[model samples]
Target: MARPVQTPAEVLGIEPAGAYHRLLLRAPGVAEAVLPGHFVTLAIGGRDSATPLRRAFSVHRADPVADTIELVFAEHGRGTRALARHRPGDTVDLVGPLGTPFPVADAPETAVLVAGGYGSAPMFSLAEAILARGGRVGFVLGAATADRLFGVAAARALTPHVAVVTDDGSYGARGRATDPLAAMIRAVGATVVHSCGPMPMLRAVTDVAVAAGARSHTAVEEAMACGFGVCMSCVLPVAGADGATRLVRSCTEGPVFDGTTVRWPEASPPEPSPSVEPREVREVREVWEVREVREGVRS
Candidate 1:
């Protein structure tokens, strides 16, 4: 694969969606190569600071035709707050379509997707691919309240069965998203399942999918400071094919993996993913070296 790009992205626009903002950016080659589960890591701080830990975001949508990519986020921290302040024509350094993409490796009759909070970021792309394969998709989205839910209306347009769950019952259903997942899969005779969310929730959804006899895929929400495997910060304990437990970098081995094999915190001895020389590791060391150094950022 061609190496993921480290280029200056121009802000195209930002649209408000309840409590979240869908931020669009122009990122040439990056948009064309992105897959369903891929993400980008942007350098924060400023140009010529030499370094800044990256803030990762799932590729909410990538429009190759427009050479633009979109990310949906809630401003929960300094990184995202900075992202929210960007205006059209502003530039940010980006590195992506990184990480292992959701395995569209199988052709299923029906696919069920489960999301928790911002984990909904990656589902639309996966849904598009599933539809292209002549498969149907259904979503079970859950958040703290109605406003925390990300893409319910957009999801409703993509798939007929979009169910939302909020703890306060301010949305489509009460309780957790997993509450209705198993029944939905069984009702649709779903042959495959995909999920992205908090680790605890993924663990629960994986159990439900396994019990329902549906093949499952997961896009894990692991913190990746490097957006590549070098940082060793985002390790996940997973069952390797050899039947031995191993720790793998979530940035490389996955942001996506077989749900059934991930060793959840309580289930097994947690082994750290072993180190491997990552392929397609982008040369972000010189990020934006070509963009004329600019002075002054927001105070």
Candidate 2:
């Protein structure tokens, strides 16, 4: 839990995905303090031009040695379309290293990481952390098709065991990631499940984990006008320890919460959080392509 900071990061590179981009930056102290699941807010339309709110993105990766961080996102609307135009060497406003991180157990135990699309962003860091501690972790990644699967290659490097699911059989197994989740948990003898994705998908994951007697935690995706709690726009109903349901802000109280305690309320689509925009929704449905280009001078 390090204190948050507001600073500008010099964009080092941009990888163009047909529909999204991977931005790498030289962020002074961001990587040093960031942990798995922490996110940063980038000012839309760049360095105070007129956009009212900053966009939040999970910390995809942090390299303390390089003093850098990476983010993956798609440009969907007015604000993000502007964000997508940034070129290397430019500066982007950032406020964070914010929100709760996926808690890694001190003792070694097997873990099952479930990610949907860019939800895979934070999971890569979490998986790395878990493995660094000599614990075992597996990935269960899903998307609409092969082009959308975010971390299959990365997950494979971390562990030989990865289960990939897609709605359309474009690649990997054809089905929901959770379709094989229960069996994956049993096969791996997992002690816990960590998940992130659409609300309905998360709700399903919670149920599967609970039935398996495994503890579960989920990183929620909500729209946020502010990365801090002040906006009051990212609230969701989650039951408290005493069993009383209260609306909580995803920014401060959590983007991460006990899976079992969340109350999605109905089978309806998740409530809108500021982060809920067209680009994100489409990317979540299925990821866009990304083409990594470094230094501009390089081919």
Work out the TM-score per prediction: 0.86, 0.87
Local distance difference test values of all predictions, in order: 0.80, 0.80
- Model 1 sits at a Cα RMSD from the real structure of 9.8
Worst 10 residues of 2 by lDDT: 288-297
Which residue pairs does candidate 2 place in steric collision?
Answer: 16-291, 17-289, 17-290, 18-289, 223-273, 223-274, 223-275, 224-274, 224-275
Report each candidate's C-alpha RMSD, comma-separated, in the order given: 9.8, 9.7
lDDT of 2 by residue, 1-299 (tens): 33688888999998875345888988898899999989999885654565656788888989999999999886756677787788998888888799988899877889999988778889988988888888898889998878777878899999877999999998899999799899889888898999988878888999999999999999987767777877566766777989877666778878889998887643124323354555535433321111111111122
Compared with the true structure, the alpha-carbon lDDT of candidate 1 equals: 0.80
lDDT of 2 at 278: 58
Error of 2 at 196 (Å): 1.2
Model 1, 111-218: lDDT tens per residue?
A: 899999878988988888888888888899999898888888879999878778999999888999899998889776788889998888888898899899998898
Cα deviation of 94, candidate 1, in Å:
0.4
Candidate 1, which segments miss by more than 4 Å at Cα?
48-51, 106-108, 266-299
Worst 10 residues of 1 by lDDT: 290-299
lDDT for 115 (candidate 2): 88
